[model samples]
Structures are given as structure tokens and as C-alpha cells.
Target: MTEPRICSDDYGILTSARDWLAAGREPALVTVLKTWGSSPRPPGSLLVMCRDAGHAGSVSGGCVEADLLERYRSGELGELPTRVDYGVNREEATRFGLPCGGRLELLVEALTDAAQLDELLAAMDAHRLLAREVDPASGRVRLRPAGPEPTFACGESGVTRVFGPAWRMLLIGAGHLSQYVSRLALMLDFDVIVCDPREEYARDWQVPGTRLVTLMPDDAVAAYTGHPRSIVLALTHDPKLDDLALLDALVSDAFYVGAIGSRRNCELRRRRLRDMGLPESQLQRLYAPVGLPIGSHTPPEIAVSILAEITALRNAAAPSAGARSITAA
Candidate 1:
């Protein structure tokens, strides 16, 4: 069992902003709308700030956080949706901790519409990716379903921002390996769920910041039928538990689907899925023998291997270690 994790990304910040607004603090939400030449954080990163000098999330990776806070204290940032830039010059870049020639552009919106924040959170809970568009002049806001992951954009009329759930994982096991994987998932800002039907194994599962479900893998897999931005990890190594979820994950739109096994077992699993009539394209999406082949034997090492591959996939980079490709039977 691990202690609860501290969530520092948009997931935590947005939720914190909702709570802060309810507590009578009208916080402004700052967004990194654009960056150029080696900025610390990527576009679309967020920071929620309050007048009393409290803040959540990050826009500069701690480089300009103190400076931003100092401005708030000095009344330099008035109550307005303002545009700001940092690292514009060499000395300023060094002072702000940006890369030598980095630049960051921000949109600081003083949010008064608690209802809009509520709507954004609701859409996320419903597993819907939303685009929140704001017109600078009129201050009109519109929220709608988003198409795909895109960087924040700005035009003459307005700013467009995308909001969605944090990364999530469904681990089909609750053993020691699952423990390690659960810890890694939480560290990566993923909402984790561990499912195992065996009462004996489930009884002692005590990882914090994760949901423990005493349900069969098939039923657990059914719960996330069409989930996007999720990873289905079959670490139980039991055919009964891993197979059902792996099958469902392959057909689902989850960004990643994987199972833990040896190369031979992965081949067997591939044949089994092919017999189940899965399309070749879909079958190719499954990373059986899941994780980079890092020669890992311990639970922690294996967990690292798994996260490395997931990180690669998330970043659109080639897998770091040796990769496994399952051919159609």
C-alpha cells in the first residue's frame, strides 16, 4: 500500500480551482498559449492563481512562478484577461530559467464564471474531451467536444483551449507487480484502477490514489468499453484474468493495450486473439510481452520497463527498449 499522490498537473489544478472558487477566491486561470525555442513546459499547460498569492499548476516549470507571484502582490497584474510573455531577452531568459533562447506566451484569464468551470469538470467526468473557446473582446465562452490533441491556438478574435481527463490506467491485477505499476501510474498523473476477482489477493491491496475493484476482468473490461486516453494493462499473467481484458482493450480506442508475458506467451496470445476474429490492424495495437525488454526480473524493474514503453507511446517516440510486434496468425 502506498500513500496518496500529489497531483500537480491540470487535473489537480482545475479541481483545486473549482474548490478555491467555491471557497470565495476568484482565481484566474493562466494558460501557456504558445512557446518558442525550447520553452520549459509545452503549450496548453495551466496555472490557477488567487489574489492572496496562492496558486496551483505550473506554466514555467518554476522559472517564472515566483515572478508571477511577485507581480500579483505588487498589483502589476490587474483584474483582467491579459497576455504576457517571458524570456523575451537574453538576461530575462536566464533570470526566468528558460532555455538560453526560449520564449513563453501566456493567457491570463480572470475566471468569474464558476458555472463554466463546473461544466468543464462535468464533461471530463463523462469522459468527453472539450474545447473551450473564449473571445477576447466580447468575453464570450463556448465549450464543445474536441477532435484530437492539439496545441492551444489563438486568432484575432479569440483563444481556443482544450480540456480533458488526466491519463488513466486499468490494471487487471492486484498483486505485487500491480502494486509497483500502480505507484508508477500515479506518479505519471494517471488515475489508476486495479481489478482482481481473487478475494485473497484483493484483500491486502492497499495502494493509495487508486481504486481497487473486486470484479472479474471481463466485467472490469466492459466498464471501459470505448474509453479513450486510457491504458489497459494486463499484469495478472493469468489467462482467465488477462485474456478477457486484453481482448476488449484491443477492440477499444484506448491509446494503449498491453499484457505481461514472455515472447512465446505473447505469440500464443496473438494466435488466441486472431482466433477470436480480431482484425489484423487492431491486433497490432496490443503490446503483448508488454514493456521494453530491459532484462528486468524484479517487480520494480519491470514496472520501470512498462512505464518506459507507455511514456514512449504517450510522447509519440519509438519505444526505448527492444520492441515486440505480434504478427497476425
Candidate 2:
């Protein structure tokens, strides 16, 4: 099985799309439109590969890429983009190594237009939701804004599905804790950015797959705009740094924002943020003394706790305020 890595998968797709557009090569993007019965990935997962750009995302374990690549190589698919289904029956299931009677489907479309690729890339960059439609007969795909309604295409040759928001995280410091957080967040498929202006901390920082900057906490917070899919964590104990970031995270669309501090310290910090024009309702979003009550003291252990809390919040789709409080003491 391909040990799935987020950076590898996401970057592969983005780079391949760009290269295909630049080289004027019309390539097909195959995404797992839907799955059923113990599939590896859920709905809306993607596997984008072309004759030129390898493959990104996975459909069924690892059994589908080689076949998809062969289809792309031969003229069987033609030059037009088409949505195709695989593993829809028992015989096909055994071929794909899907246990029992598992099945999967794909929307394969030869990306002939730069405009469609550009739009999808732009939506990804902005962390917005996008719904793409592809006709199996004509091999044409359409891009549009996604609505609240959940829709899936079941036809043999059409692809209709949503590409929701990108995973994102905001690290409030560039110190050791921030480094650990950033590294782990990348593994969890987050678009991570670390903010700190202290020269001592920013000078010797190095973590791959994370954006590092020396922006002030308040200014960095201004950039978040509180989107619903974001998570913010303040690692620095420095009041100036943690406070402003916490303030911004409290008001933004960030689903989780936490600060590292003792219980008493968290109380004081909350009071300060509340005094700084942050409403009581907004302040409720702040997750001070972050992480579950695991009695973690070491940096890595603390990081594990923090990541666990974030995962729980995401999977539950619950607000931070309503989450059960952690009493590490």
C-alpha cells in the first residue's frame, strides 16, 4: 500500500496541474467521486494523474493507479475528458483488492482547458469550496460554487462532486513548540503557517511543508479572517504574542484556537482579551491551556495532545466552546 503523505499528494496534484497547463498538454483528472463499504477514503477524495504528471490521491488501496495510467497512455480514452467507474461489481472488486463486495467510482476528465484548471487552482488557494461537473459522453467539465446541498453523481460517465475547503492551521510562535506543531499539522494535511517576529526565534527555524514568517501576532491574526475550517494555536508563552493571536482567532472562522498556559494564566489571558474589545461570545472560542488533559509535560507529548484535540474537534464538527473542558491538574 502507498503510505499516504499529505504534502506529497497535494503537491503532486498542484504541480501536475500547473505543468499540464504550461505545456499545453490536455490531461485527465481522476477523482474518487464516491465510495461504499469499507473504502480507504471517504467521498470527495481525489486522485489526479496525467500522461505527464504521475498521480496524486488514491482510490482503492493502490490497485487503481496503474490501470488509470494505462488508460491515459493508450488512446482508449481519446483526447477528451471522461468520467469512468471502476470496482462496481464482484469480479472488479477482487481485481482491485477490495474486500468482500466493495466498489469505487472515478470521474476522469481530460483537462483540455487552462481556464478550468486555473479556476480550480484558485479555489484551492483561497481555501474555498468548489463543485466540478463532467459529462461522460462529451468529456466536458464545468466548475461552479458549491451550495449547502449534498449531491453525488451515479452515472457511468458523469462526475458531479464538491471540493471543499483546504485544511489550514495557524501557529502563534516560531519556537520549538511551534516547530513541533507545524510538523505534526503538515502530517494531518493542514496548510500551516508559523508567525513570530522575535529575531532569536525566527533566525534558526527550519521545518519543511510549513510557511515561516516574522509577522507580529496581531498582524498575522488579521490575515486569518476567522474562516470556519481553520485552527489556530498559540505556542508562545509571551503575553504580547499569545494574546493578539488568541484575540484574532477568537473572532475568526477558525474552528479551534488554543494557547499554552497554566489554568490561572489562561484565566488572566481571557480577561485581557475580553478587555481588548473581544466580545464574550467570541472569547468563548478561545481554547486556553490547550490540549486534552493528558498530563503531558514534554514538547512532543504536548504536541500529541494538541493534535488529538484538533482531530476530535474536526471529526465531531463541534465548536471549541461547547467541547468538554480539559482539567490537566
Candidate 3:
């Protein structure tokens, strides 16, 4: 007997939808199109619901899925791609359990073939960023290569949603602090890679969902497929190791390059790198003190600060006052 399949995350949703289609079930793929005011899910959130009421992913927290399923079951929803609105007013918001002032539009399209799903899933499996362009009026869709990030846009031309591999984090150490950072980065959907040549430190490193590299730190950076979606962190606190990684990372396209150290040590390291002939422009890219100025001490707290700063920069948001605060002694 064939075992049942398992699915998780956004990619898994499409995988499950493809499976349902293969089993002769017409599954409707729902995408949150536009949201006004407050919303349970963002504009790009996806949900795939089978004719049997089985569903994967979520457009709303849980408020509207049932009603959506009922509409499809009762034939209120059509085969052609169409748009539906929910919570247009206060009464409707209350009925759908949506927050006050919450309103959203959804585009639902029924899948009759697994061809497109197969193609998109293949691209994702190959770690290639891909975007799906959907024409709601014509029930047509096409795929194209996308940038390093996922983005959703809708306009007079229809809808475009980008999906692909997760961002990556390369930690140039397998020490205690690196352990905490790796775990947190994994939780945040980063493909974490920890590199350490020292068996003494690497032997005890066993963080699940993270790749361990025994290559020299500099060599690891070179082999990591440096790209705009990658980040490199030096947490060994050893100039010999961290400096080598930083030297290569700062010159690469990694979105963030950071080294964990005190102010004095950071300045000294910067001076050393500058003296080694690293251009002033490249030298400025180093996040020497690493993380935010949150004044974190312990390994876990320090991990939080590091990830928080990365998250802020990744989202292109300004650091909040609290995040920029130096904890009082």
C-alpha cells in the first residue's frame, strides 16, 4: 500500500494540492488577494481546499475556511477563477469572526491538472526562485524565474506571487553561542550552516535542521553559494577563525555580515582588516558589534538580539528604540 504523504509550510500546501489533483479531486487554490484595515492573513497567504472539504494552508486564521468550504460544496463557487470578498462591514466582520474593520478579497481557482503545480514544485525543489502569474479573468497561469525574495503583487494585469527557497544563514562557528544562533535561525526559516574546523568545538555541535561543515571558515564561505539571500555570522570570537570568514563574507553578496565581539575588539578587528587592504567601502559593511545594541549577555539572549537585528534589516525596517537601547548596568 502507498503511504500517505506529509506536507508542511507553503511549499507543502502546493504539494498537497497536487496530490489531491492526482487523485481525481478538484482542489480550489485560494489566495488572499487584497486586505483592507486589519486582517487575519496577509495578501499572499494561500489555501487549497479539496472537494471533500479537506484543506491545506490558511488564508484566514480559521474564521472563514469553513464558510469557504461550504460555499464550494454547495456549488456557490465556480470552476473558473473568481474573486470573493469577506468582512465588507461590521456585521459581516462579526459573522466571519474577523477583527473589526477587517476586510479581504480572495482569488480562488480550481485545479484540473497538476502540470503547473509540478513545474512550480520542481523549481522549489531545485532551490530556484519562481513566480506564478495568474489571470483571474481568464483562468490562465504561467511561471517565471523570480528574485531571491518572495513577493506578491496585484494590479490591472492580474496577480503575481513569488515563491522559492528559504533564506540561508552561515555561522562561522559551532561554539555555544553558535548553537543558540543556529537553533533560532532554524526557527525563523533560515537554512542554517555552521562551519568549524576544530573537532573539539564541532564534535559537540548537534543542532537539528542545521548543516555542519568541517571546512576552514574561509573555505566554507566560498562553498556556501553566497547570494543576496544569504547571511554570514562570525560567532567563534577567535580572530583567527572569525576574521577569515568575515574577510570573504564582506566581499560577497551576503545580505548581512556580522561578527560577535566587544566594542574594543570589534574596532581592533576592523583596523586589522583595513590594514590588510580591504577597501573602506567593504569594511563599512561589517556589523562588528553584531546584533542590535540591546546589550544581551547570555548566549540565548545574545542569539535573540542577533536574529532580531537580522530580521529588522532583512525586512528593511528601522530598528525600534528599544532594540537600539543599551541595557542599563
Number of the top TM-score candidate: 3
Best by lDDT: 3
Cα-based TM-score, every candidate: 0.86, 0.77, 0.88
- Evaluate model 2: give its lDDT: 0.72
Mark the regions of model 2 whose C-alpha exceeds 4 Å error after superposition.
1-11, 21-26, 51-54, 71-85, 89-91, 123-140, 145-166, 316-321, 325-329
Which pairs of residues have clashing backbones in candidate 3? none
Q: List the candidates ranked by lDDT, beginning with the highest.
A: 3, 1, 2
Each model's RMSD to truth, in Å? 3.8, 5.6, 4.6
Q: lDDT: which is higher, 1 or 3?
A: 3
Worst 10 residues of 3 by lDDT: 320-329
lDDT of 3 at 101: 73
**Per-residue alpha-carbon lDDT of candidate 3 for residues 14-82, written as tens digits (9 for 90 to 100):** 899999999987899999999987898888899999879999989987879999999998889866588
Instruction: Kindly list the per-residue Cα lDDT of model 2 for residues 135-204, writing each as its tens digit.
Output: 7678667788875434355466666776545567878888887777788888887878788899998888
